[model samples]
Target: MNRLNLFAPDVRENPYPFYATLRRESPVCQVDPNGMWVVTRYDDIVAALKNTQVFSSAGLRVASEPPHLQRHNPLSDSLILADPPRHSQLRNLIGRAFTATTVASLETRMRSTAARLADEMLQRRVVDFVPDFAHRAQANALVQLLGLDPSLQPNFQRWTTDILSVAAISPDDERRMQDVRRSIDEMEQYMNDLLASRRRQPGDDLVSGLLRSRVNDCALTDEDLMGFLFLLFVAGLETAVTLMTHMALILARLPGWMDRLRKELDLIPHFIEEVLRFEPPVHATMRLTLADTELSGVRLPAHAVVALLVGSALRDEAKFQDPDLFEPARRAQASLAFGHGAHACIGAFLARAQARVVLEELLSRCRRVELRAERLDWNVSLNTRCPLALPIEVIPA
Candidate 1:
């Protein structure tokens, strides 16, 4: 059989069919050329996520680093690259700022923001839902939640996109790395200033919260503070933006589902889950084998990179009945969308709340949302699954 070229344009357009074929033929197949094993079956992917010891996030980071960046190993100790105890410590320190109460309280504000954005879109008639609605709302919500200055919104957005772009392709490109380094330097300087100001006079924001957090009986160091800030700015904004954009595009395409959702507005939560399953914003997550491991009887050497095709796992027929079909009503079951085990998204609750508020407001306020363009363009990134543009006409209620 021919090798599966996931990067091929045809595969990117609609990869489910190929994924199904891979699951059937070789659930754990190695793309020898890339030195990466691709896991397609749902069960194996779940196992890999849960079994962090064997399939480590450290390997994932190294795999993600571009060939040029691999030499310097710039991200040697980032939270996402760490394993076990250290990962737990760092994650816990940052996770404190995103507690349930903290996120829940933001719902009212998020709802207000979503409604205001949707109302404005209605006034415009034709709207690019991605940038105007999804991107703006997600970015604004995150900025407010993190307590960053509103003036930094545009710069933050640009830096977030550039960082993710670097991750998606050409991790080692010197010019791009230089640009990223410059952005990081600026972000660090801004954050350090903010941290110092917060130290003098504390405020109700994430940076302040971090300043208050203690690890190993000591206040967070500058490296810890800056690293956490960097992680939050990129992951918090990019994932939420992509998820919102994908949700909008999917609803626009599947009018029947959209109509049903409009009628049953309370089902927005379930609908979001289905969207995560059907067209997840995070297509794949990379992992490395910390120790020699066997997956589905295939022997993998220690340090071997493995790319878990999360999109494929979500639609794995063996796990979910009629996986391809969008069924939000399925009995409340767990999915790997937010991931599983320890490294699961700390901001999952916040993301869901934000998405729910956006969809709820859109459905309640808009009478009809019709697609204005023939083809929707998707952002070409390996990790993030989102559309570049989703043009639609919003008819007010």
Candidate 2:
């Protein structure tokens, strides 16, 4: 059996070359230590993602059951981890907040929020863009979306960070697992308080909307509400922050692209899509097989763990021309960055809207958001790899 360390720092930092080799030599290979299989080819991953019957989305809670700190335990309840009638029900119920009109309505507020953060970044001697700008913008957008106090942005950062840090760890690592549990407990408490207040005041926010919505005559129970909130808490802002950070790194390299963007504002959306292809925030997602199955001629056992390396697939030579190169104008089909099928990212448009607004601000205000390309820090985990700190200096345009 061939093996690869999905958690290795070097691999996490630059997994493209390794993924190319994996895709060519062994598209479906079993990895030791964790007894997991990896899917490196784009087509195989797409097939797996779309084939929810064979590749079940269950067992998301298994890893975080005991010694693990999980973002959402009993994950079966969450839409991301659910299937069939239940999944459709939840997605339809939550889909209202992200409708095109709703997001368009929020554009002004989102842009204003990004502009304020951009101004703050401009004032800094040397700003760590993650915490200083991208993280702040994401936190603000999420707070308003959920009707939470703006002062709790730091808390959101801590809770999401702690919860996400436990990915791919040994379930027996009790120490880290306990820490994750504590974070989840604290965040859940905060969520409970918010839910109560929303119940009383019934504001015009996502939580309140979910509280009022009933899909197929089904309403949100207390458990369902908490699970849904957990999904948004982790998924809502984290991807946007990472996407902005990745774009900053890219813009720093193509210092002249800012001027190009100014001349052709239309390229902004394409540029964001390319960034998602080249350096997506999420690298992999886990699925358990419902029955013994075959993927790309490789046999997989029933109840086995398989990791769909969509991040690697995004850079597959078979899928994209010059897969390793970052070109802003590349015309291509949608990448698996936002995932596919029933498990696809529901907040995709909302996140993209936030990223586009902030990104426009960046290109317009800064002569170039400068970063030391070679010194970038990345979060190395089983699921995603995101830039940790982009020490950027903004030269006002």
In every candidate, how many clashes are there? 0, 0
Provide TM-scores for the models: 0.92, 0.94
Q: Give residue 58's lDDT in candidate 1 (0 to 100).
A: 65
Q: What digit string (tens of lDDT, one per residue) describes model 2 on residues 120-203?
A: 878874788888888888888787788888877778887887666665556778786777778788878888999999899997
Best by lDDT: 2
The alpha-carbon deviation from the true structure for residue 370 of candidate 1, after best TM-score superposition, in angstroms, is 2.0
Tens digits of per-residue lDDT, candidate 1, 1-397, equal 8788776667777889999998888888776436468898888988898898888886666543566543322334457676787788888777766587887877888888898999899889899987888878877887777777888877877777655655544544678777766665677677778778888998787678878887668665677676667776777787788789878777767777767888777677888988888887678888888888877887878887788888999998877899988788984344577777887877778778888889888888876678888765566665666667888988777
- The residue ranges of model 1 lying beyond 4 angstroms of the native Cα positions read 32-35, 60-77, 167-173, 215-219, 332-334
Model 1 RMSD in Å is 2.5
Off by over 4 Å in 2: 67-76, 166-175
